[model samples]
Target: MKKTALITGANKGIGFEIGRQLGRKGWRVLLGIRNTLNGRDAEEKLQSLGIDAVFVKVDVADPDSIINAAEILAADGTRIDVLINNAAILEDRGTTINTPRGLLEKTLMTNTSGPFNVILAFLPLLGNGSRIINISSGLGVTADMKDYAAAYSISKAALNAVTKQFAAALAGREISVNAVCPGWVKTSMGGAGATRSVEKGAETPVWLATEADSSLTGKFFRDKKEIPF
Candidate 1:
């Protein structure tokens, strides 16, 4: 049977590239976007290439939206083999010390809590041997800490902790949960000076979703190699 993959924020950027690559590999790609129009366009783009793809509307920042999305998919009896939490934001342009009020809260809502909500809401749809890939960032790595995108970085750090928590919680069921930093890819969020392409940025997440050892869980990865969290 063809496997199914669900990718949030998959209408564009690295998320879209990951879905496209997985679709090319014969996986049923579910484009999880908050916007119906863009999601349908992405679905059509993939279908034009003879890839089995569908659009699932979801807004990770809102728990209600996520819960409703889960209900719809469950009603369809969908079993997700891979779940990629790729939706996030980077609106904080100030340093941690001088960060404005509400920026961190806003970032955490979408970046940290978003994945947590997505995983919990979709938990029933995921079975044994399923994979959960959180598209985190090098900015989140405490070992190589930086002050750029203060709120965004802090949110990713929390997300890494969340990954480990779920990995341990689901270990008995053979479900693998891990975090991946896609690097500074040239996406709308990554800006124009980013050195990596979307294809390169999507590589490790795709690997974790499809090729990585099922036993590898609760780790951070970049370029398909393990890295310090």
Candidate 2:
């Protein structure tokens, strides 16, 4: 049977590119989006390109939404081979001193807690040899931490920790869980001046999802190479 992958925030940017590439590789791609209209549009676009793509309504920020999506997949008996936690937000680019408390909380809610909740809801569908790719960032690395984008950075750091915890928890099950930094891609979150293209940004995650060694888990990666967290 063809493998299946679900990518949150898959309506655009690197998430969309990951879906497209994985679909091209003959994997069934589930486009997880908050908006039904956008998800349908993305699904249709992928289908137009001869990809087996489906739209799954998922709002990672909302626990109910994540649970609903998991229920839908469970009802369909969808066995997810890969789960990409690509949904994230960069609400405030300000320094730690200037970033609002509400913005930090909101950022953590979406980027960190949301992925954790999704993983929990869908854990049953994932089995041995399954892959979990959490989209993190270089800013999340404490060794190279900076002051800018404090909210976004902090959330991603927490996400990396989540990856490590899950890796340990799932070690006996043979499920691989890791984090990848897509680099400074030219997405809405990365802005217009970023250097990398969406395809380039999606490459590592796609590789991790399909081609990386199953034995490899609980690591941070960038450009298909391991990096320090």
Candidate 3:
């Protein structure tokens, strides 16, 4: 049977590249996009390239959307072998003490809670040997914590905690949960000045999805190597 991968926010950026790479390898790719037009466009583009790609509407911030998307897949009896939580936002431009009133909470809604809900909503689709990859960041590393993009960083740290919690909680069933820091890729969020290309950023994530050791769970990675969280 062909493997299936579901990537959140896969219409563009690293998420899209991950879907492209996986699709090229003959896996069925599901683009979890919130925008209908963009999702259809992405699917058409990938299809033109001979990739097995489909778009499923999912707004991570809304539980109803997530549940609805999950229900769609369930109705089709689809099994998600790889689930990538790649949707995130960076909305800070100042120090933490000077941060806006609802910045942290807003960021948490998308970066932290979104992934948590995604994991829960799709847990039934994942079975033994399934992989769950969370797109985290270096700013989330407690040892290297700084004030840069405080809300985004803090949310990812919380996400790392989520990864570890799920890793331990689901280990007995042979499921693996891990986080990846796709270092400063040149995307809309990373900006043009960023060092890494989209392919470089997607390398470790694709690896974790397709080639990593099944026992390697509850870890943070970058460039295919484990890093401190």
Candidate 4:
């Protein structure tokens, strides 16, 4: 059977590129998007490239949406080999002191809690050898923490904690849970002035999804190299 991968926020940016790369490798790609129109457009684009792609309506911030997505996949009897938690929001670039409480809450709702909810809802479909990749950031690294983008940084840090927690919880089950920092890529979230291209940024996550060693779990990585969390 062909491996299947589900990527959240795959309508555009790094998430879209990850799905494209995986599809090119003959993996069944589930492109999860909040907007139905964007999801259909992405699916068509991937199909035009001869990729087997499906659109899944998912709004990561909402638990009901996540549950519904899981239900849809369950109804189809689709088992996911890889789950990429790539849907994240950068609400503000303010420092911890300057960031608003509401902004922090909103950022965590989508970036941190959203992934957790998705993981729980889809856990039944993920069996042995399943890979869970959380698209985290260097800004979340505790050793490298600065004052910039405090809300986003905090949310990702919490996500890293989630990665480690799940990795430990699922170790005996042959599941791998790891967090990846895609670097300063030029995406909608990273903006145009950013340094790295979308392909370059998507490289590590795709590798982790399809090719990384199974022993490499519960770790944080960038460019396939382990980084300090």
Candidate 4: segments with Cα more than 4 A from true spot: none
Better of 1 and 4 by TM-score: 4
Alpha-carbon lDDT of model 3: 0.95
- Model 1's number of clashes is 0
How well does candidate 1 score on lDDT at residue 18? Answer: 95
Per-residue lDDT over 126-191 for candidate 2, one digit per residue giving the tens place of the 0 to 100 score: 988899999999999988888898999999999999999999999999999999999999999899
Candidate 2 regions off by >4 Å?
Answer: none
Q: Model 3: per-residue lDDT, tens digit, 1-229?
A: 9999999999999999999999999999999999999999999999999999999999998889999999999999999999999998888968888878999999999999999999999999998999999999999998898767799889999999999999999999999999999999999999999999999999999999999999999999999999988
TM-score of 3: 0.99
> Which lDDT tens digits does candidate 1 get at residues 120-147?
9999999999999999999999887776
lDDT of 1: 0.94
Q: Which lDDT value does model 4 have at 65?
A: 96
Residue 59, candidate 4: C-alpha displacement in angstroms: 0.4
Output the TM-score of candidate 1: 0.98
Off by more than 4 A, model 3: none
Model 4's TM-score against the true structure = 0.98
Report the C-alpha displacement of residue 60, candidate 2, in angstroms: 0.2
- Cα miss at 79, model 3 (Å)? 0.5
Query: Backbone clashes per model, in order?
Result: 0, 0, 0, 0
